[model samples]
Target chain A: MKQQSKARAHTNIALIKYWGKRDNKLFLPMNSSLSLTLDAFYSETSVELSDSFEADSFILNDQPQNSQETAKISHFLDLFRQTAGIKTAAKVVSQNFVPTAAGLASSASAFAALGAAMNHATGLNLDLAELSTYVRRGSGSATRSVYGGFVEWQMGTTSADSLAVEIDDASWDIGMITVAVNTNKKTLSSRDGMKLTVETSAFYPAWLESAAKDLVSIKEAIHKQDFQQLGEITESNGMKMHGTMLGATPPFSYWEALTVEVLTKIREIRRQGWQCYFTMDAGPNVKILCRYSDAEAIQKLLTTAFPDNPVIISKVGSGVKLI
Target chain B: MKQQSKARAHTNIALIKYWGKRDNKLFLPMNSSLSLTLDAFYSETSVELSDSFEADSFILNDQPQNSQETAKISHFLDLFRQTAGIKTAAKVVSQNFVPTAAGLASSASAFAALGAAMNHATGLNLDLAELSTYVRRGSGSATRSVYGGFVEWQMGTTSADSLAVEIDDASWDIGMITVAVNTNKKTLSSRDGMKLTVETSAFYPAWLESAAKDLVSIKEAIHKQDFQQLGEITESNGMKMHGTMLGATPPFSYWEALTVEVLTKIREIRRQGWQCYFTMDAGPNVKILCRYSDAEAIQKLLTTAFPDNPVIISKVGSGVKLI
Candidate 1:
């Protein structure tokens, strides 16, 4: 077994979001989801296995995590240890290049990097598709982070079948601009929100249905290189996922005042004959899906409108790799 | 037939909102809805029948309406004229005390008063429930405005059965405060919005199911005078209705930046031990449902939070009556 290994993984933003979970513990999503991997946001994780270590330790961004955070990492590491038949404890250090827990899918890259680093450290050389099931057990969206460009996390009936598949190279003139409306940690985690929505929201079933349809059409759009169809489906699917939360008992919304303002500006931008569309996750921040040719122009307008917020443009990114 | 008749009708705020239409021409909703009539906003209309008039004329707020507006009223008046077996032309003078086309249900009071005035002018002795069928042709929500206090518009199989019925007298300690975020005309009318939502929204079927359940629960809450239960259902139902719009083909939202700000402020007010909740229609405005005893206190907080907007309080109102 290797003493230490390091891996880096890029974050992905879901065009068709995965909301409710069919199996919470296994992290099996109720519907299939598709995402575009971006070059701008990622996580680098290094795992070191030692027989002398009393317990697993996790240090994030040079800060030793508390018991709860460390325990979560330790629990995830056990899955790889069991697969490789190792009893040694490991020390995991993770650094996030994106905003943590602000609906930027920080957890996706974090888990993907962790999974890749552990697989190397524990001598479990599984392929990307097989490794994605393990990454999904960490965070559902992390399943897609195992692949590059446009990836789809199929909602298979079992853990063996539910895995990420690369749909396209995403070599076309497609990119994204992330508007950091708020970088603070979200009050409700996506896991908790999904549980609440599945349990209490009457719209959950319909969300699953719409997501299934969106996945099929989005794949077709990607194949046809139809930017308009792909962008519309992306925005509609994201909004529909958020819409389910509004029907939960004691309904909740992640939108802030600036979120609506950003949406209004995006609508105005589209009205000016630009082919840009906006999508949001479980936070107030907005992501504009546009052609790479118009990224600078759209970024300029967004920066002018929101001087306080950070506007980031990212190109198509690659899959996880050992560093 | 009487030379002239004048009638006044109060506006209503739906606790369980009516969104999509099952039958567009008849104005029949896909699901039943319940509402509370408010004393603050209303409209008064005076209708005069005459054989000398070659065409129908409409004067709203003492200003002559254009052909389009007059034609809409004239078309509504035709429903009443057919019932009364009259070929006489009518001069309709209508005045709205509330903000017009602002999602304040101004059309509810306007159409209700017109129906009452036309009924009296043509010597039709139909009861309030019977007249509601004719008013429904003007606007779906106007059917509920024909009655005072808590009223339910049942989504029956046909036009005659899909009429408003009084649920309660609303003698309890309950009222509402309207935070007029934007009183200007809405970009998308409710009629158009409903059609788009029903046809394009994938979440529309789920909305119908939820509305049916909300209607039953809200009615029970009204019968028991349970303010908390009533307030929760009101906010959930309204938010669910708006949620459906976000799933349309080209998604749209009536929410403005100030609208979300107002909702956040209301949530903060609730967290501070105030028994107040908010409900919104197809516009940016928000209405806070609170106990009459807490109405003033809640209104004061909202006014302090949004000093630029008008914060108007309304108590239980009466049904339509002739002048």
Candidate 2:
């Protein structure tokens, strides 16, 4: 039989969150955050041991990766090699199945998929927590993507303790509508942004303090399967994350004119008696969390409201699995 | 007594700093910040009770004031009327002697002088602390400008307790250099930016927790008259404040190309054994804190480095006083 290659993986979105780093090199966070792994948007990442190249090679979205772009991949490969006791080079090719132009947690799904695929390829028999640690080393949010359904990336003080855990299977009533304003890469990377917040913003401490409470409330809401509570917390957290940007000494604004317009429209829709709420992650795009039945109507409304923009409706997804 | 119509006040820079609000309407802070009053930059205002006009008028930098531009003054007047039981209208004209393009704390000076002048006009025997509280109700930072030399704006839980206090009457060796970059106003207002930070930035809490330490250390340095320590702390705090902005969800960058160039040059100069440090407020302009004797040389060096930019040099200034 032809050598079975590692399976592809997808990314996930955090309903709770994982922010800040205890260790820059290790990507260790000060606390854990919870998330829900959605089915519709994901990245298919396959890793295989290759003897041809001296270094790891990454092909992202069917394009050849540059040195800067593959840095994270190489870092992950190095860790994988150290763990698996293999000196051979590896090849990582990822095809993102996430909706075109949809602003979703592609990184979370991508890294989580990669983590699981690489783990399976190496036959490490690592537990979910170990897999999450490896995923977090690649991207902070990816740690939570290791499991499907409702998940949490616990902000443990140490890398050993900080790992993603499944909170609930989320097989029931949860749906999302991702409004894609632009699919172009963000101007600022989350890693660089987090570093900047640690170094500069005066209100950073207050954000950290409040986030813990938000995380706690979100967890409780998730346990109760309270979509309304979950949506509210997620939206509030998203807004809070945006707020820090405004207070940085010299100050910066993440808002495009369209961002405000979309937000206002979302609020208007919410006022119109739809059980819908919105959350944004590191981009101008907004994802509306609502009942699975409401997804179609919300998408239609958003499409009409934002005729120039594209919207993608998705259902609750499964965790990382071999394709 | 020439009607004692003209009054002048100087602005102050917060070395320790105060950020966040307990109450939006009252401008109460979560903690107090310490600052230094600079002799170099100040605003002079002449207020005269007028019977000609039905409303208070303001003239800024020799330009005629419009109603919309005088909103802050109007807000202050309304507050003053409620506090001091004053029913009369006044005409106010103010000139800022400080470099218009420089990012010095002009509002602090403007409001400080305004507070003093309004007090004089109203014959309200409000003490410095009470005056600070009153001014702070208008602008949070203005409270620190009430006192000269080393001043602190205590971030008390309530507006009544959150007042600016005099630390040391900074008679010692301290100098400042203002580097004018872009004269155009920033896109993000400090008020909105700070509010966003408090609401969003994940690193905000860490910043708040550590700020007290920074405040304590910098105060000790100021008490010991250690320019080196003072400069280091000020620069670090300024950088930290700017960092939070970058971490905001969509992320924002307040840096201009010139900011990078100037910062590089400043670092290069420091490597050449100069005891100079830089701090920036909400604008692209930079202010360097150095010893009195080194001010001229540093200014000359900076001017040479950026031939197109204007540099203003000034000494440690006095607080707001009757002219």
Model 1 chain A poorest ten-residue lDDT run: A98-107
Candidate whose TM-score is highest: 1
Tens-digit lDDT track of model 2 for A1-88: 0112555554666655555676988888755667767778788888887666688788988899998878878778677678888776
Candidate 1's residue-wise lDDT over B258-279, tens digit each?
A: 9999999999999999988899
TM-score against truth, every candidate: 0.97, 0.60
Please provide TM-scores computed only on chain A for all of the candidate models, following their numbering. Answer: 0.96, 0.92
Candidate 2, residues B1-323, lDDT tens digits: the string is 11225667787776655656768899887666777778878888877665556877788988878778787787786766677666567778888876766666578788878778877776675888888998887678888888888888878766677888788887777887888878787787777777776776565565677568788888899889998888888877766666555445434445665775677678778888888887777667787888878888888899898888888887777777877
TM-score of chain B of each: 0.97, 0.93
DockQ of 1: 0.84
Error of 2 at B258 (Å): 6.3
In angstroms, give how far residue B297 of model 1 lies from its true place.
1.0
Give me the chain B TM-score of candidate 1.
Answer: 0.97
